[model samples]
Target: MAVIGSVAEFTAEEDWEEYCERLEQYFLANNIKDTETEKRRRAVFLSVTGGKTYELLKTLLAPQKPTENTYEELWQVLQNHLSPKPVVIAGWYWFWTVRQKAGQSVSQYLAELRRLAEKCQFGNFLNDALRDMFVIGLLDTAVQKKLLSETQLTLDKAYHVAMSHESAVQQVEEIQGASKQQVNKVKEHRDPQKEKGVISAEGHPMSQMIVSFEKSCVSRVVTRAM
Candidate 1:
């Protein structure tokens, strides 16, 4: 079948299993099957590979213009070259050392942790380890509390609770900020001395002082006219 957008090109840095799955699925959907004639299958396989993959393909096909081969041979060769033996150690180091950065959202942080976990491939040990790592990496203590308080937890559930709690906290903080701004605006318009109820030496209020000043101005005008 013809594809609409281009299929994703495999890169060395990507998850090996996921990349392989995508390629295999593409082949399966397009009828590039194992039972098919080698000539047609080989052409389709070559069409999909790019970047460093072509180099691997050439090495596998050397001494002859590879007119025929199964897609599985190409798959194995790419996996052998792309996925190194030492990556397990490096993946563990990264997973253990990973911490959530300040201002990073919970979703983004958890997704990163999940990727590192996949690299380790620690079997059944991964579940609780992932859960614990997520809680440990959270930047906010309050959200951490909410996450840990759950009696039975999955990473998915914990993420939901923490994200909702964070949203609620942010909303409350925004409301308080808006309220504080309104109060500040009111105070900005206020007369501080009058609000403090300070009286003049003769015990007249400030309003009387303004009226007296007006009367004095009128008297001065009449005297000038005379």
Candidate 2:
């Protein structure tokens, strides 16, 4: 079998929820069943740093060390230490306060909101809350209006509508930009007479004395100023 990717490394610098998500994705891609404790434990062992592994092993005591062999127990123990109830509550606070930032794309902002939602774990209200948060957090009033125009909007509904609307708007902007470029290119093929300020269509040597006239005007202005 081909290796899909390297194991997810979880160090102190990584966020708990993000690390868990990475691990989950890696597991899914590799067909590593989480229910298989031995395989999960082996994967976890390879993924974590030596120190983190040691810490996990030390969570159990005496003869009970062997009993803590399962990956579920290890995960639960890590959760207890790394992300207890207070930490999870703080995650929810941050989730509620998150707003789409300036210069952040719609897709990026949406992906971030979804990650924050995972951390918050809003239970049965998660779907509705996700929709409300997504709609409320958008920086673009036009997109928000388009999403809100729907009589009923769930998270999936809002995501699809917003994505489609944003895509359409982007497409129109791109077309207009391309059209403007073509127009400018056409305009750039200017009349040589205008560029040279000579040989006019009216069939004259088109004012060769223009620069002299301009200099005289400037001289007069300067003389008046002095």
Candidate 3:
């Protein structure tokens, strides 16, 4: 049967869990079922894994040949090699101490918390742990207070509330900034007119003083002539 999908060579830089998931999907698409002889699936897996990965697997299997192991065994061995489990205590410490960094948005911070929580083994308490960490890590005091005031806060609720608060603050700042600019423009527009009025008022008084001085001089000259 023709295969419907292709699997790329697994690399050290790639996530092992994600790659495994994709590989399983490829198997399903191609009608490669476990009910068939284990040998067929193993051969198919070994063939498509590429030379570099096969060589690594050969080195890992060592004393035994790849053919001696079943498909499930080979997959398990690679999983153990590629994705070693993290220490639970250290993972928990990192998860608890993490805070929302400056310039990071609420969603970005939430993604980081989820990533750290993967190794924490929180099990059934995962959502509660996430919600608590999210509230503690927030840089916005108002958002923190709002979340804290909620009686039935879940991770979903916290995320939505924080996002809404952040959006509202940005909109308010934009409006206030625009208002200040408009006020300054109006003041600038009136300033030239005010200055011109002041100049006209001062000139009128100066012209009257000059006329009075001229009249006094003429009167003095006439009296002297008389």
TM-score of each: 0.68, 0.59, 0.78
- Tens digits of lDDT, candidate 1, 1-226: 5753345666777777777677667767766666655566666666766656676667767854434455667667667766656578888889988999988888899889988898888899887888889988888887787677878988777777767766655655565565456555555665667755664333334434544654565455434422
TM-score of 1: 0.68
After TM-score superposition, what is the CA distance of residue 40 in candidate 3 from its true location, in Å? Answer: 3.0
Question: What are the per-residue Cα lDDT tens digits for candidate 2 across 1-226?
Answer: 7858765456777766567677767667877765655765554554553566555657543345624556666666667767666567887888889999987777888888888887676889888888898999988787788778888778887787667666665655565565455445544564775656654433332332433444565555434422
Model 3: CA > 4 A from native: 177-226
Query: What lDDT score belongs to each candidate, Candidate 1 first?
Result: 0.69, 0.66, 0.81
Which model scores highest in lDDT?
3
Model 3, TM vs. native: 0.78
lDDT for predicted candidate 2 compared with the true structure: 0.66
C-alpha lDDT (0 to 100) for residue 216 of candidate 1:
62
Q: Which stretches of candidate 2 lie over 4 Å from their true place?
A: 1-10, 14-52, 55-77, 86-88, 194-226
**Model 3, clash count?**
0
Q: After superposition, how far is residue 139 of candidate 3 from its true place, in Å?
A: 0.7
Model 1: how far residue 23 lies from native, Å: 2.9
Tell me the alpha-carbon RMSD of every candidate. 15.7, 13.5, 19.2
